[model samples]
Target: MTGSSHPVIDVRDVSKSVNGPEGRLDILSDVAMQVNGGESFAIVGASGSGKTTLLGLLAGLDTPTRGSIQLDGHALEQLDEEARADLRRRLVGFVFQSFHLLPALTAEQNVMLPLELEGNRAAREKARTALEAVGLGPRRSYYPAQLSGGEQQRVAIARAFVHSPRVLFADEPTGNLDRRTGRHVCDLLFALNRDHGTTLVLVTHDLPLAERCARCVQLQEGRLEPLA
Candidate 1:
């Protein structure tokens, strides 16, 4: 399938608020950002700064209370949950800090889940290749509990990249790993980005990690400011 020339993610004047015990609390306010195809962008902020919220909004995992978000040229605000989920299945992949793998599934099984969900006939072969790419070929049979934190995270990364998604959203992908392991994971992520031309939108608090991205946007009270 030919890739779209339009920006993979476009957010304009987006704001989100929630009801607090006392009153309404705005998590994000008037935030605008764009991530072009194959670009690596970072959202950096302190805890409670709404970085994750912005990432979720950009990935169409959550809706913005106000403003607009266009993902792969489709207006997200107009789509219902099912439609948004369909779009996500087609264009997006995500890696989370927690390495959310199914405990009952082996590493290969976890990677195979997405391909199987898409009804691909080569799911096992594809899953094997993906695990091998992450240097976990021998551990393909290991379940999440059988692997170390770094290994589990690598499996998660493989799962996200298995389908060669056009847009990848990572939320503090290395947060659970040690410094050395985190560096290795980051290297793998960038290598995949280079080889597949996947657009990467990462939310992180790690300064050096954020610096590795092509562009960095900092969020404060849900507003974006380009990092100098």
Candidate 2:
């Protein structure tokens, strides 16, 4: 899927800071990284180490206070919020720790949301295929509340992959599951990544999970420390 040597995601001299009650709080500083197309990258850190913050920036959910980021060759800093969102819809998918499924929607509907947002007329059929891919075709009618933790996560995974985005951002994807379930979810994630050639950027506190990525880096005191 990666046809060129250019990076799919690039971050250069990025920093983020916010004004807290006491004073300015620096959450990230001087971060630089590149993730190529079809590659798997991991960011690991302790609590308050800015892992999530960095993930948000990388995914264009937030902007760095200084420096630049490019996603799929688009300069995120040059895009407005609306334009950034449009770019994300066209190229990005996300899976999160809590599953982030809408309780009111059935599994199929949850998986169809992305396509529906894009006005895709075949959303239902595409969603069915995605659910089947995740081995949840038989459970399509179930709501998040009726499903187990692992099942819900699988549905979330289905939703994330249904659109075949160029990039997938997973933040603590298995955090709420038991060890066995976590392992299963992790396997499914990597399988999708490999099979679909999606660039994967994962943020995790689970070291074993981090080790599974092709490259890994740690965020210590808001700075990137390479691990591999």
Candidate 3:
């Protein structure tokens, strides 16, 4: 599905707003974009510029106040919460700055989660394979508290890719690590993406990291503009 004719993500004339004590505050307005299958792009923006909001909507985790979003041929606005969750499980993976691993679960258990949810009988073996791919096989029994920041993030990455999602949304993937460690984690990310042909959508404020992406778009004033 990497180079499929249909776009993996499509946003059209989308807007999102929420009521504030002062008034209605708009997060995004009239934003539209298309992410081609297997393409990698970063949504770069300063704080409060709505990059994460747009990513959330595109990911079907949040909905637009107006307009439409299509994810892998399904209309986001049309799906109910359950359907949206199903779609996400089938086609999407996520990595966050905080490395949202379950504190009690070991690396292998965390990686097996998605497969277990889908009732996969081979979840244990598959999880081991994913951890190996991220060079975490030896740490499969390690708890999050026992691993370094980069290792925890690698576990998160392994969990994300274990399901072989078509699109992977990463928010500040390298924000919490040292420069050298961040570079190594980034290398693993793009390498796995290349291996699996997953379309990568990363959100970050780091200009250098953004420039490393295949393409980047800036989110400004509640709208998107391609970086020149």
Candidate 4:
């Protein structure tokens, strides 16, 4: 995926704004970026600088108010919600700081959900393999409430990567863990990305985490800069 002719993520003159009680509020003003497949890109910014909003737009979870976003060469703005979801199932994966695993489902079950949705017949086996990759094979039967924070995050990682997405968007992936545990999670994140050749886009405030990426850009005043 290296030396790719086209970027996996291409955002052109994108902007997002929301209606507030005070009237219209502009969150992100015209910003553009290109991220190649298999490359790690970090988005660092101060709180409320719209980093998360931009990530949401790039992932097709939200549409841009102005301009356009191209993910894996498909124009996001042109797709309907169902089409966007279908495209996400086929190409995108997500990791969040909150470790958004279901409270009721077992670890393996959670990991298998995405595959099941896609009608993959070997969902259970693939989920087990994903669990093994994250070193949670023995804990696959445990539910989220029964696991520690780091372990829960590991399960979320397993769930995210189970279907082998071409791109992974992680938002504050290590924000909930202690230093030692955060480092371990970070290592696992990079390992998963490397092994799968998945494009990595991370939004974080941690300098060390930002440094791990091949390219780091800061969002300031609703804009992206190579250096903040």
Candidate 5:
């Protein structure tokens, strides 16, 4: 799927607002972007700059107030909640700064969760391979509490890509780690993105991290701004 002609994500005239105590609060205003298949695109902004809000919309976790989003060629606003969730299950993967692994599950079990949800019979085997890819094969039996921050994030990354999603959304993936460990995670992410030909949509406040992407767009006080 290298150099794919079709866009995996397309956003047009999108605006998102929420009712606040003061009045209406706009989180995004008429944002438009097209992320081509297999492209690495970054949504970079400062804290409270609506980066996460836009990521959620792109991933179909939430809907925009005034426009359409096409994810993997499906109109997200046209899908109901369950249909949108199903779409996410089929096409989207995510990594968060908090390392959202289940506390009670072992690394292997955590990695297997997505496959198991889809009733995959080879969940265990696939999870083992994913963990091995992340250099955590030997720690498959360890719980999240037993692993260091870096190891936990590694597990999260493995779990994210285990089902082989079309788009991988990462929100400040390195925010919780030290500089050295963060670099390792970044390398792993890009390697997987390359090998899998997966569309990477990264949201981060760190300019250096955002710079790694092929293209980048910044959000400023809820408006889209081109980054030089």
Candidate 6:
């Protein structure tokens, strides 16, 4: 599988369950999916349908309770936390719905973090370029609080792309913006995908956004169904 160069992500019979107050709760079950390199994919479903959980597993942020997940040829379940973190740093980038920016860091600093962690000497310059790419260059010095909701989200997008990761995971990226703003953000996201040929796995409720991807999978009652 490693020698072959087809799939970037492969999940086989994956399931996730958690211990709840009532008992065990199954969040996802028997989910199998694959996304090829340089492909754009989407997971669309209603709230509590395990879309985010699937994204986390794909990104190696969380381990599935059952089955195997191979991300970029590495087995996620076999990696320790430190190894997973290292892999994420090296190969994965994430954009959260909440825009999880460090309050103490300005937009530039936030975008620079990943590059700095990777020991890149041009962190500041690369960060600046990413911000400029997202049309937030003028607000590079501003903290998250100083920016509008849309501006803050733009910063997050910049941060996610600054490292030029092999794969990008976005969970409800446009959830916080108005319709027009969301459309703009979506366009920017796809533009980045086009420019970099990055593999994209997005969990979104936006039908148009989902339709833009090469493939779309839907979650219903913790099970995956093909969206035709």
Number of the top lDDT candidate:
5
lDDT of 5 by residue, 53-79 (tens): 999999888999999999988999999
- For candidate 6, give the lDDT of residue 125: 98
What's the lDDT for all of these models? 0.91, 0.93, 0.91, 0.91, 0.94, 0.91
Query: RMSD, model 5, all Cα superposed?
Result: 0.9
Question: What C-alpha lDDT, on a 0 to 100 scale, does residue 64 get in candidate 5?
Answer: 96
Greater lDDT among 4 and 5 belongs to: 5
Global lDDT for candidate 6?
Answer: 0.91
**Candidate 2 on 1-228: residue-level lDDT in tens?**
442467999999999999999999999999999998898889999989999999999888999999999998899989899999999999999999998898999999999999999999999999999999989999999999999999999999999999999999999999999999999999999998888889899999999999999899999999999875
Task: Please give the lDDT score at residue 215 for candidate 6.
Answer: 84
lDDT for 152 in candidate 4 is: 94
Which candidate should be chosen as best, given TM-score against the real structure? 5
Residue 184 lDDT (model 2) = 95
Model 4 clashing residue pairs (backbone): none
- Candidate 2, which ten residues in sequence have the lowest lDDT sum? 1-10
Which order, best to worst by TM-score? 5, 2, 4, 3, 1, 6
Report the lDDT of model 3 for residue 77: 98
lDDT string, candidate 3, 86-196, tens digits: 999999999999999999999999999999999999999999999999999999999999999999999999999998899999999999999999999989988877777
**How many residue pairs clash in each candidate at the backbone level?**
0, 0, 0, 0, 0, 0
- Each model's TM-score? 0.96, 0.97, 0.97, 0.97, 0.98, 0.95
Q: Model 6: per-residue lDDT, tens digit, 92-142?
A: 889988999999999999999989888999999999999999999999999
Per-residue lDDT tens digits for candidate 1, residues 170-207, read 99999999999999999988888878889888899998
Give RMSD to native, each candidate: 2.0, 1.2, 1.3, 1.1, 0.9, 2.7
Query: The CA-based lDDT of model 2 is what?
Result: 0.93
